[model samples]
Target: MHETDVAIIGAGPVGLFAVFECGMLKMRCTVIDALDAIGGQCTALYPEKPIYDIPAHPAIAGGDLIAALDRQIAPFAPRLLLGQRVERMTDLGDGWIVIATSAGETVRAKAVIIAAGAGAFGPNRPPLPGIEAFEATSGVRYFVNKREDFRGKSVVIAGGGDSAVDWALSLKDIAAKVMFVHRRPKFRAAPETVAQLEAAAERGEVEMVVPYQLHGLAGDDGVLRAVEVATLKGEIRTLPADHLLAFFGLSMELGPIAEWGLGLTHNHVTVTPATCETNIPGVFAIGDIATYPGKLKLILQGFSEAAMAAHAIHPRVFPGEALHFEYSTSKGVKTA
Candidate 1:
């Protein structure tokens, strides 16, 4: 059994920042994540993807942001258990809570924070036949973990979302041939990205198969040789491709949290904006997993929520102690 002042049920960026906030109040934290590594979706889903809205930085890659967060919380020395999910939470009474993980680890904490953003997630696979076969043979990939894998190979990307456009641009110079096929004429990606993609299409560096949808796959023994696509008007054609990159987004599952009796609105746990505390006492929710009035699912917003939850939980962790909040610049972090 492990013991801590707070048990955080996610090791994503928001959860990592929570450790910093709680540590500022001199509280210990143990963070648990279902992924084998920390950073959650940022690391798992789109590490190479660029984020523009994070404060200070004009633009930062997803993986870099996670690394920065990791360094920021290093002073806290918080315990991190990766590839584990908190399966059950029991009230031990007298302000103590027991959190049991799927990995057979038990943690006792004074408070709990449910920062599991979108819970467990998996790629939204496209509906093309034999897609799973291609997946098994490495001919089709949903997310790009490494751009070098497609070097000097013909690659066809399907989708109009940011992931599709971003990967197309990222892999254009590396891949021998890069083609982007989308169902609509106008891409759903950011304006600048769309402009870049359009310019690339015009320059002949990347082929644009617009107003077309993935219709079929042509391959031998699961090795894709070409991709069959159909226009919305029913015209069909085949595009030569060694690999198919489909960025159809992700399917989120709330998993056990939905059965935990917490008040939920459209799958997001309902929380008070003031403290990010959920309907359940001592169980707070933050980040994208939390829902409240006028809520914005931004990382900066989640950082603020983490601070709020930590302050709200301070009194419970140190019963009679009053928290004297101070800025990091005023009272610099002291490494434990």
Candidate 2:
């Protein structure tokens, strides 16, 4: 059993920032995450993708942004528990007890913060017959966490969303042959990204297959060799490929937190307007898992909410003493 002033459930950007914020307030923190590393989706989903709205830099890769954030919070020296999932939370009459399963190890803590952004939405695979068998043999990959693994391999990507297009563009120079297959002609990616992909296809850098869906997968020696696709005109065609990558966006699962009796709307924890406190006392929800009036799910907004939640907790933890204050450009006097 370990004790801490706060325990964050997810080690994403929001939760990592919360750890630093709490440390500045002279409070101890413990961060728990399901993945082997921190940075959550940024590191796991698309590390090579560039982000433009991070405030300080005009553009930064997802991996680099996470690294910078990790460096900023390193001085805090917060406890990090990776590959852990909170099974249940109980009120211990004094504070709270968080019971978690971390790589087969049982752990406990106080004051849990749910910062799980789009919680554990596993990869979406195409509805194709024999795909399961192919996947079991390592012929199909649903997530593109590692881009270099497909070097010199024939790869076929499915989906027109950001993830699919981004991976396609990133693998163009690495993979032996890269092909993008989308059910829609127009992409849901950014205009610039879509244009770049189109230009790549025009220059023979990549192949584009539109308005088609996968029907089946065929392989040799338990490894994918060809893909069967169904055209919009009800025609079937076979394409040779070494690997199949599906980036059909993710579907979120609320997990046991949804049954914790916390007030929720549309499967998201409901919180107060200014402070990120939930309906339950001493419990707060931040980042994408939290929802309030006019709440927009963004990294910057989550950082602000985490700060507010920490301030609100300081007074409750120490009822008599005057809480310390910090000057903020947006909000004048904030207690920590």
Candidate 3:
């Protein structure tokens, strides 16, 4: 059993920032994440994708932004528990008891913050017949962890979301034949990303299959060979494909913590808009896991929520200290 003033549940951008904010308030902190490394979904899902709305830089890769955030908070030296998932949480007399499961080991912590972003939500698979058979045969991939495996292979991606488009663009150069199949005519990705993808399509680097849904997967000898698609104009076509990648989206699971009598709306924990405090005392939710009035689900918004949560925890963790603090950056001589 380990004890800490705060135990953040996810090591994503929000959770990492929370660790630093808690440290600034002179509170001991420990962060646990289900992934082996930090940076959560940003690192796990779309690290190579560019993020343009982070306020400071005009454009930064998701992986680079995560690394910069990690560097900014390195001085805190927060304890990190990777590859762990919170199995259960029980409210004890004084504080809450969190049981995290990782590789057959159960670790306990005092206070817990559920920062599991879309990670808690498993991948959404297209409901196409024979798709399961192909997946079982290792011919279908749901989440792409390594891009090199698909090199020189004819790949078909399904989905109109950011993940699907970003991956289509990322693999355009590596994949011999890349095709993006979306049920909708318009994409949901950033306009700039959409423009880039359109250019790739125009240059014959990628093919766009609009207003189409995967109908079935065909394979021979337990390996995928092609896919059957139904287009919007009542036309069905079969395309040769070596691999099928489904990035339709994800469905979130609140996990066991949802049954802890916490107030929730639409399966998301409700928190105070300003403080990020939940209905339960000593329990706070941050990042995409939390919802409040006028709350927008963005990494920048999560950072602000974490700072507010830290301010609220200061009184409970540290007796009567003033909560005013500032982050100091090292000065460098500039020659312009």
CA-lDDT, candidates in order: 0.90, 0.80, 0.79
Minimal lDDT window, size 10, model 2: 327-336
Model 3 lDDT per residue over 37-150, tens place: 998777876676666678888777778888987886777777888887767666675655555565444445455667778437666777776667788866787666677888
List candidate 1 segments past 4 Å from native: none
Kindly give the number of clashing pairs for every candidate.
0, 0, 0
Cα deviation at 329, candidate 3, in Å, is 3.3
lDDT of predicted model 3: 0.79
Question: Could you give the candidate ranking by TM-score, starting with the highest?
Answer: 1, 3, 2
Q: Which candidate ranks first by lDDT, i.e. highest?
A: 1
In candidate 3, clashing pairs total 0
Candidate 2 per-residue C-alpha lDDT over 42-81 given as tens digits, one digit per residue, 9 for 90 to 100:
8887776666567888777788888887886777788888
Residue-level lDDT of model 1, residues 33-108, one tens digit each, is 9999999988987787777779999889889999999988999899999888988888777899898989999999
Residue 232 displacement in candidate 2 (angstroms): 2.7
Clashing pairs in 1: none
